[model samples]
Target: MVVRSLAAPPTPWSKNLVEPKIESSAFVHPFSNIIGDVTIGANVMVAPGTSIRADEGAPFYIGEGTNIQDGVVINGLEQGRVIGDDGKQYSVWIGKNTSITHMALIHGPAYVGDNCFIGFRSTVFNARIGHGCIVMMHALIQDVEVPAGKFVPSGAVITNQQQADRLPDVEADDREFARYIVGVNDALRAGYLCASDEACITSIRNELTSTSSSDSSNGSSRNISTSSMMTSPYLSQDTIAQVRNLLQQGYKIGTEHVDERKFRTGSWKSCTPITAKRESEVIAELEACMANHAGEYVRMFGIDPKGKRRVMEKIIQRPDGQQIAQPAATKENSFSGSYRSYQPSVATTSATSGQINQDTVAQVRHLIQQGFKIGTEHVDERRFRTGSWQSCTPISASSESQAISELEACMANHAGEYVRMFGIDPKGKRRVMETIIQRPGGNQIAAPSNSHRSSAFSQPQPAPTYNNKSSASSTRLQPEVVEQIRQLIAQGNRVSAEHVDQRRFRTGSWTSCGPVDSTSASAAIAAIESFLSEYEGEYVRLIGIDSNKRRILETIIQRP
Candidate 1:
């Protein structure tokens, strides 16, 4: 018996013990212990309070580029565990760049593959892990085989046995166990068990086998090997041709060439294996067929399919004749002129109806032909004129031509008016006004009246002159004197329009005034009083009143 040392002699304490022999830089904590027949890899960082012990019969191999973090304990038991190939015990294979984090325990007779992250405080016992797996924190993984690219979330307790066994009265069935094993094998080949735990694998295997056995008893032979059935010679040519093409494209045939363990138990095992002579003949036939039908194949299939079939087709058809073009119609019998109609189509009705008037249509056409925008206001005004009021539609060729004629006539009549209002050429002014009014805050500017001005007057007249300078001055002051008399008459006395007119005449200086009715006199009196109170004038007076002689006549008449 070969006896080996269980532990190495302790070295002087340091913050990290990274051996020169290891390719990776591992930061091993001073408090933790690592001993005996263990190899560490590149870029590995071991955190505080971690222990790695290899005391078993087999050596422990930690793969290239892995991290073992704080408080993790990795140990191998001395007892041998059997796996694959003739009951031999092999060394534990920890794959590249895996991270085993804090407080996780990995017991040996296990294998973990590359790029895996084992989460904190998880227990992995007797497991086979595949590449790119994430075993989350606080998960209890026992007696399981985890496949590639699997994620096990935190706090999950994964047990090897099925759920039925957890019941008190339930007994494990041998048939069920056999079924479970077969189902797991099926799942592995189908790639469905990539993230399977022990219980999941067991369940899948049991279900698959049970279903398969039932199908088998019904006389269905769906699981029979493809090659077991004799091939017809007729199909052999096509089959061989297809196989040859597939192989040329880098597809592998038969289980032996690829990983045999990754394949299903009976899948493609009995197919006639590719041989050098058969391969050559198939390739030669495919090439000949492709050459014969190259033109037709190119026409029928697009570039991609034609290229693919160029190396694939074993049988091909002859090319058809050249494509023919239809004959053109003679000028005398052409349908083009007959199809032309001035009336707009139903689709164009809204676009071409009263929404675009004959005048606007003419104007728009001219502008488009000249490569200019019809003035925005011209466009807007025309929209309103045509009863649509708001819309921006592209001018049609016919409509554009019509609009040009109408715009010319409109410009001839309104050019002077436009210049007077906008102080620019009518067209330029229209464009500027549209631009200004279309701006975000342009609504603040007063909008011009939509009503058109009459063309009767081209220029405004001068101010009118009065007959006499004093009469002109008196006329100006007449409104003020009438206003004063109107105020005097309104002291609780009802005054008529004639009496107000007489009082205005009595003040000869105010002769230019017009007669006022009772309603007018009352309103005028109120207005005058309000003006005097507001202005606080000192020289305000009522003129032309009767003196003491009128009082003597009134006293004599009272005695009689």
Candidate 2:
């Protein structure tokens, strides 16, 4: 439904009444508002929230079979009138079969020619739009002349003659875009005309049934019955033809993915896939198209699908024109883990890296908490080392020290643990970190001076203190338990009682497994490998109990 956004000014403007001349056949929807000296031709559809006012200047003329779609605002500016071939004076002239889509603002003296599309939220002020031209969404044309069949990219702003001159020539004179718009409008008009016609709806349904039955019996291709075509008082033969052509082009025509058991053996049937309606599926289809068949895919799924394809195509390509391989499992939230486990390793590494005099370990831990990629090879590549010298700020140490510290952290942590903390492998956590730390430098980072290395590890260290708690009440976390937590944390996940199930980890229940710290960490960790071994190529979740008294779910773990 259309809603008016403006009210009349308190200061009086001219109240002279000039009734709008709208054709009886045209549909000026209840939500659209038409004011003084406006002339709408036959079969035009003035959709919801459209405001066409010719109050201050020459009359506005909308030609036949045009569509003024939702939220279009057409205003007449005070300018010298242009005389048409028919000797009529005009300020704003929209030609036949044109489509002015949602939220576009056209201010006259502007001339929009036949079969043109004024895309979503685009603006045309004192401009000339030639036939079959496309003014894409959010584009602006101010006092400029767009030649016929031209394509204007989204967000393009053409203001002057020089700017207009620089515009590339229209790609093709085929007018495919124009035809598609007209076809869509024609379908809308036909549907609107048929919605209230009970007899017509019944006839169409019968026709569809008969057509399907006949196709099944005769083994013939599907076709619509001519007699049951959408042709009411509101829809002419041209409109029907346009709708039929659109259907033939496969725009939202209802069909199914029929599984013909006799023809194919696969679980999924070899048939036309159902149309994707959800936003996610649309995005997926667009992505698939970009990676494979762009042109054909865009043509099939048309709602600005090609724009995303183009963007992704560019993103996945190197400057040298080679395609970049997408990272298999790099995105944050791909896994999760606890942060407390990696604290000591990070501290020890910092101590070895000559940052023992400062709280570099705390800084690194803070970076991980703040989402930095300190775990992987990206560390050497310097992913987090940019921007202001904050948490990701470079440690004041030699490259050798940094490499050794990063390597120690990677080995001490579980796979995917770095990603959970930092979202990337900053130091090539597995392979590169191992290689770089061993390389020659001033002094080996592994061997910190005796004075600084003294506190790196303590023999029979006391249980971690919290709020001045006593050692009797606080139990020291086992190395295995800490390692388990590290593994879970690296995977970017957390253990909770809610995720426990009968599937994989095979521990009957949290109560049956006894306390979290009671079990050997090796056995619990081994259960993951054992589960995968027992399942043998099948996917399963490895469940276990964490020290926090919650269940841990290692999802869909498939071992090679």
Candidate 3:
């Protein structure tokens, strides 16, 4: 093996030529390469083609009885360092009895605890794998520390805390399987050393020519796993069938996703659009997008190219702490006439119906789960237009039913007035959301009045889709979502709208459609309706500016 020392960089703390301190009992194959400041403990086996280089991020440690299989790479960045199990800092630490299988990578600022099994071609970077964990093939573990004894399924992209917290625990069968691999490798370690005898080498040369000829004649029989030949596990039968369904319905497919933080503020960036013409090519493109955004919040939409609007949409990945449901196959003709408009299916009427607005129940549950305090505000129509809000009785509810009961009672007392629901951060003391749940008269006013409308947007508009959906007979502003632009305008806020097609959504290159003046509520609603119909099949959002220029709120009014 190319075991050698190298001079440390010219730094304040490092000033010496460092060498690898390998234990005498460890077997490092001749073809394996070991470099500066690396320590290998007793009984460890480094197979052929394994590379352990600590030249940059120095002082790597491999504990006793660990096996580094062929084609493994252990390298680290020059800057990052991880806290080791013994309370010392290390660039990379592999604890005792761990098995890093073929083609796996253990990048620095990383740690693998004792008795772990890192599967083939998997990667662990800027992260920790707890003791006895089994990370399956092609998985990615980064940025978060996995708890002890958890199991990571194949192709998992774990990059955030929420995902790391929710991983399943390792089972008894999994532990036994990992132990079996270690036992088998221990046998192979002994056998490989004895196979270096002169007689053994002579016998191998006899059939070498024949073996080469046979390999050439029957290459398919060889055990090989290449990236190009493998299908991504994330690209399942259901995803492909969904793609086919969208395409057959004369709708083009597109995808967009965002990390947890950005997804909260209604910001989404698109992935590579499925631009292929052939059926197989489209499926491949779809697969590529799914594989690329495996960990983030991904949204798939069916676009109407001619009109520039989204005809259908669904969230494929829920990164916001929602329980991930497995993708169910879309049945024949089952994908049509369902979910035409974007609405929360779960938030609608369900088991938790009578006490609160079931259509916005998901938000209430989420706010509570995130430890936000719920509150409410009320005002008459005149006060609402003047931005004056009076606080209702403080609701320190721990349960959804309790919170909703208080909210419904508050609205009942202030009937015919405007009441809004809000959630506040106890720590920061800021409102997370302030949505108007009730409007004046507790009724939908006969078609919005057109007086005081912006001259450029003076044309009358048809009834909006929001006014048509309701649980029973009555329709109201969505509980969590206000009447969007119309409600914000009615509240005396200056509303501005922006529109973008499927292509421009990727870059967030929005085109301004102009602002709605502080006019009559009907006029503002009409202006928003005009923008919606004009930009049909596109994404449209309203920015509520509170006139003083200090406060602003953004709400997506329309999306395809």
Best by TM-score, which number?
3
Q: Which is the better candidate, 1 or 3, if ranked by TM-score?
A: 3
Worst 10 residues of 1 by lDDT: 551-560
List ranges where model 3 is wrong by over 4 Å: 1-16, 201-560
- Per-model TM-score on C-alpha atoms: 0.26, 0.38, 0.39
lDDT of 1: 0.37
Question: In candidate 1, which residue ranges exceed 4 Å CA deviation?
Answer: 1-21, 81-91, 161-560
lDDT of 2 by residue, 1-560 (tens): 22232232321223674677888888776667777787888888887678887777658899999999889999876765654435687988899888898899998888898888787899998888887777666778887787877766555667766556545444332254456566566667667667657988889999999998887785522223233343232223432332234333333312112122211111211124436553333334323433342221111211123222211100122123232222221111111121001112223223323312222333333334434344333122122112111122222222323433443443333222211112233453321111011111121112111111111211222223223111112233322223333344434434221122332222111112222231333334444334434545332333434345343332222212
| Winner of 1 and 2 under lDDT | 2
Best of the candidates, lDDT: 3
User: Could you tell me how far off, in angstroms, the CA of residue 253 lies in candidate 1 after the best superposition?
Assistant: 53
TM-score of 2: 0.38
Residues 296-355 of candidate 1 have per-residue lDDT tens digits of: 321110011322312111112213322211122211111122121111111121112222
Please give the ranking of all candidate structures by TM-score, highest first, separated by commas.
3, 2, 1
lDDT of 3 by residue, 139-232 (tens): 7889999999987765566777767777768766567557756766667776676577667656777679779888768665442322222343
Q: Which candidate do you rate higher for lDDT, 2 or 3?
A: 3
Question: lDDT values of the candidates?
Answer: 0.37, 0.45, 0.63
